[model samples]
Target: MPAVKPDLETADAVAKPILIRAGVALIFGLTTVFVQEPSTLWMKVAFALYLVFSGSAMWEYLRREPVPVAMRSPLSMAAAAWMLGTIVLLFLSAPQAIGLTVAAALAVGGVAELVAWFGHRRAFLPARDQLITGLAGLGSGVALALGSHLNPHGQLGIVGGGAIIIGTLLAVSGVGMALDVRKARNLEADRAPGRVD
Candidate 1:
């Protein structure tokens, strides 16, 4: 597969959505971290909101960006997972149900990201970032599923920890990608025809 050349528009398109996602994850992580013992209601509210916001961000990415064919399906499935999870969380107050819903969403989304990365590893720079996020998501999902018998607090901790890790990773990757694209554009312009030393 041919690599997509980085440029100003592409940089902005990718960076903006990624940074938005990072911000969302960080915000959710912080909220969960500060809460001493999150109640079932609190978990439902926070998880629902996070899923809605993050899923919308992913939808916006799909709508605005010219995503590669190999990635479009997986990304769509990930977004759908979030949406369905959001709906389930909104209705379910039991800890086990909530845990299971979250686990399914995270696992599905994580697998989607990994599949996208595997299929298009050579096509874009963000594929590396996707790998990290995928692993984090998958790990979090498995942890949550295993701890489904635990109380709300345990589930909150696992999900919150994962959010923070993924948030930091994406934030760093987005900033680095933007800078790299800018540098590439500058170098290309400098080496253009009729350029003077």
Candidate 2:
């Protein structure tokens, strides 16, 4: 073989998180698969695990994507500050923790945008990619968390587990750029080229 590029460390750094994302996805997928019977505490533990995964994935996606100069100019420090503040605030909110956590995520995403603008000179996305991904991830994850609606016996198997599947769907959506691209092309082919294709 030709000389190997010496980037094992860098490659590992990148692969580690993507692998973690896949693992989390698998956990969620499996949770969905076996929604028939699971312990109450296990269900809660699974959801908690999901929350951690979402936070990690969001953190990675933001830091990796190139900031449009304008967006970079705006979001850097703001996002960093909010990310720290909300992590603490959301955790302390107890029963309302899930909702608070989602709010914090939204704020974190917003801050990322601001950081992007400040660091660069423009907004990274016209559609605010970070916000959309974060919210969907947060919302679905929370929906799953809140699924445990006081069902002493049924919470885990029914509500909680179902929510896990839903949250997994959201997470996949966030990470599915290639899928989106394929969908876009398919839709565009159905339309004429210039007509918003």
Candidate 3:
């Protein structure tokens, strides 16, 4: 039987979304520093777009065959849906309501990652990475929630800070994951018969 050749196109498809998301996160993080008000229309729109991009990237990642089945738990699906829903609610609901919703979603996502970590700890790479990412989400979520309550003005401080943290985290993780995928693909190609580097 002929060996299945590694598909560069497939590899690119998997890596592209992650890189794009990382870029967006980095850009958003940098811009958030200058944003004085979190409730502004532009900020809301940007966040809405972020949700859309994040949900799309997750959907793509879940579609990849290399991802473990254990990682695609119901909780993960719910988190993706919540992100999408938050985009809609950002425009329709009050700022505080949306902020609360985001905080809750982040918390749930963090818990989901923690579960994934414990469930698949033997896998090492994914388990450890998920734990780190999960902790980032959990910490940021808690901070955002606290900021909402502590500031009588608004969640600008919390949101801005959270954006920077989340952005940096996502960007780093995204790049790392992309590089891993690329390396795996290259290794597979090298192993194929008649293939030259």
Clashing residue pairs in candidate 1 (N, C-alpha, C atoms within 3 angstroms): none
For residues 111-159, what per-residue lDDT tens digits would candidate 1 score against the true structure?
A: 9889988987777656667787888888888999999988777788888
The TM-score that candidate 3 achieves is: 0.69
Model 3: lDDT to the true structure? 0.59
Model 2, which residues run further than 4 Å from truth?
1-23, 68-147, 150-197
Better of 2 and 3 by TM-score: 3
Q: Tally clashing residue pairs in candidate 3.
A: 0
- Write candidate 3's Cα lDDT for 100-153 as tens digits: 656666666667777877787675343454566567666756876766454312
The Cα RMSD of model 2 versus the native structure comes to 11.7
Q: Against the true structure, what is each candidate's TM-score?
A: 0.86, 0.40, 0.69
Model 2 Cα lDDT, one tens digit per residue, 88-186? 543442333433443444344445543443443332222233343334434543543465344323433332343344345444544454344456557
Return the lDDT, model 3, position 128: 50
Every candidate's lDDT = 0.82, 0.43, 0.59
Q: Which ten residues in a row have the lowest lDDT in candidate 2?
A: 1-10
The reply for model 1, stretches above 4 Å from the true place, is 1-8, 180-197
Instruction: Tell me how far the alpha carbon of residue 113 in candidate 2 is from the true structure, in angstroms, after superposition.
Output: 10
